[model samples]
Target: MKATWNGVTLAESDDTVVVEGNHYFPESSLKREYVSFSNHRTSCAWKGQAHYYSLFVNGEMNPDAVWYYPEPSEAAAQIKGRVAFWKGVKVEE
Candidate 1:
């Protein structure tokens, strides 16, 4: 899968974990140069707390557009070390 936003590729990986219709790409697949820190956070009963990373690409900012569970619950362990995109970011094959 490839995650793109603002005409830039945020991440791309053939190996992905799908949960709740979102494709979680490997952390290593992310293009760190386009990533920025974000204090935003959210929780999922089964996935634990999710941390966020905003994207800065093509002179545009997409806040909290990427999220990942730093320490996911046992049931969601498969997603550990992975990140997923949303907030208008497109994930496609």
Candidate 2:
């Protein structure tokens, strides 16, 4: 899968974990240069707390567009070390 926003590729990986209809890409697959810190956070009853990352690509900012569970619950362990995109970011094959 490939994740893209603002006409830029945020991440691409053949190996992705699908949970709750989102494709979680490997952390290493992300193009870090286009990512920035986001203080935003959300919690999932079964997934634990999710941290966020905003996207900055081609002079546009997509705040809190990426999220991942730093320490997912055992039920969601498969998503560890992975990131998922949203807030208008497209994930496709």
List candidate 1 segments past 4 Å from native: none
Local accuracy of candidate 2 as per-residue lDDT tens digits, 1-93: 899898888999999999989999999999999999999999898899999999999888989999999999999999999999999999998
Scored by Cα lDDT, where does model 1 land? 0.95
Instruction: Give one digit per residue, the lDDT tens place, for model 1 in 1-93.
Output: 899898888899999999999999999999999999999999998899999999999888999999999999999999999999999999998
Clash count for candidate 1 is 0
After superposing candidate 2, which stretches have Cα over 4 Å from the reference? none
Q: After superposition, how far is residue 39 of candidate 2 from its true place, in Å?
A: 0.6
Clashing pairs for model 1 are none
